[model samples]
Target: MYDALVVGAGPAGLMYSRVLAAKGFKVAVVEKNEQLAVKPCGEGISARVLKTAEIEKSDYNRFISHVIKGAVIVAPNGKEVIVKEEGEMGYVIDKKNFLRVMGEYSASTGAEIYMKEPVKELTFQKDHWLVKTRTMELEAKLLVGADGYLSFVSRTLGLEKPGERKVIPAIQYVMPNVDVHDPDMTYFFLGNDVAPKGYVWIFPKDGRLANVGIGVQGAAPKAYLDKFIKMHPEIFKKVDILEFRGAAVTIGGMLSEIVTDHAILIGEAAGQVIPLTGGGIHTSIAGGKIAAEVTAKALEEGNLSKQRLSEYKDKYNEYWGKRIKDSLKGLHAIEKLSDDELNQLAEILSPEDVVNLANGENVASVAVKLLKHPLFSIKLARALLS
Candidate 1:
């Protein structure tokens, strides 16, 4: 029996496996996909995550774009506000290469990896958990579900049902020769005309190559995405489509319980994405690290009950749970803004306010800026007063 069996060899699973293996745990990571890092995602990681994760500069190579700036928010009326920040702003990563590097790192630490072996079910036996794959049954002392959305591990572990709200769906594509100014800056388009109850993004990868995507809540995301793209002929005219993809992002926040008697859910399986921005790469990696730390401690103490596993919840709450709750509040505020309201609000905000919001600074500052607007002032005042 292995010390821990990690399902899904994505960033979260690999990171946890690496950390655990380095600490002398017998870990194994199983992946359904034949290759790693092939998920359909926006492929963007902020500088804050890079620094916090201790990702070395030498490990970047072709996996990173060093343009250190911020993003541009464009309203429906063509009004644009560029939010700038100091230090390493963000990176547009080649996610494939990055995942390969992470996999190699985990392997170097003696974590066994199995590709093309999808887990079908999981059950608890005497003093161990049994993971059932197509051709084999693996037993482990602990199970970590690092699978993405639609995670079977989470399903079998009885944490699959989303609470009040499910995640939004996103459609993305890689466009070549796109004529976008300030390649160092990412762009977001707000308004129902572009994406109904959602937003569109243009993240530059390199010279004239960028990732263009849009996300929308509710069903029929593709319909809204199609209409949004068609409405923006000016931006799409000079672009050549290279790749097209779509995926669902969990943003409703974590379930009431992520850890049980012998299983734990991490990453998207636990709904760790930021509700406002729909970004989860950093949070997922952090979740993996935290899960590893908690599981390791539990193993050392010879305790693996739900009570002992509550350490994962406590650590996550101490670290990122408050941030997730704050982002959810912000999401609700943004959802209340109409196109005209957003455009007007953008005019009222200074560059510093935008920077503060993006950098996860003071929430009151952002609320105050919103309150300055005549239309939203009353709502903001009520929110502040309450």
Candidate 2:
């Protein structure tokens, strides 16, 4: 029997496994994919949360495709705002390399990674979790679910979805030879016409290659992407389409419950995704490390009760619960804002304000900042109320 069994070999699971192995606990990680991180993602990771993950800079530097210095945000009415700071602000990483490093690190710490092994069902008996995979059954003192939004373990456990659960269908085109305005900057387009209840992004991986994508609350993502390209002929025209890929993203904020007596959920399974930006890399790293610590303590004490595991929830709430809640409120506010109202709000908000909001800062604090610009307060009020 292993000390811990982790489902899904994504960033979340790998991080948890790595921590457990470092603590001298036997860890097993199961992943369905033959290769790691082949899925569609924005591939953007912020520097703020990297400190928490404790990934050495020299190790991940090879994976950074581009250093994003700032963001160029275009409002619904085509009004533009630039939010950035001195030096590098974030990274457009080669996610495959990032996952490779994480996997290597986990293995180096004595974790047994089972690739292409999909978990079938979970059975808890005799103070151990019976994890039934495609080929065999293994027992573990603790179970951690990191499978993602459509998690089988979470469903099997009968944990209800959080109220903030709103899925966005997103599509992306890997276009090479594309003429971009700035490779150092990430671009965002906001409006119902471009992306209904969502947004469009252009993150450059190189001088001539960019990830052009759109996330929409509505179903027709392709139609909106077509419209977006037509509107920006100067940049997208004559570009060679490398490939197209997409997946559904759960920007539903956090889940209601992420822990049980003997089972714990992390990453998307726990709904740790940020609502406003649909970014989960930072949150995943933080959650994975936190859960690993709680699990290690639980193992040391030999107490695997849900009541003890609930400490995971308590720690997460103390750390990230309020930030996620504030970001969810900001998401609701954006959903309520009109095209004109959004433009007005964007114009008045400083880059610092945008940064704070994007980083999951309090919306009420943002409202207080808007007091300097009186017109924004009314629009912000309307957005909040709506």
Best by lDDT: 2
Worst 10 residues of 1 by lDDT: 377-386
For model 2, the local distance difference test gives 0.83
Off by over 4 Å in 2: 161-164, 371-386
Across residues 1-386, which tens digit of lDDT does each residue of candidate 2 receive? Answer: 99999998888998999998999999999987788986788887776755776789888676888889989988988787898888988889888888888888899999999988899878989899998888878999999999987788788887745343567888889888667787889998998777888889999995678888988885599999988898888888898778799887878777787788788999888888888888888888888888999999999999988889888878887867667767777787677667877777887787777866766765666778775666666655445323
In candidate 1, list every pair of residues with a backbone clash: none
Residue 272's lDDT within candidate 2 is 83
In angstroms, give how far residue 382 of model 2 lies from its true place: 8.4
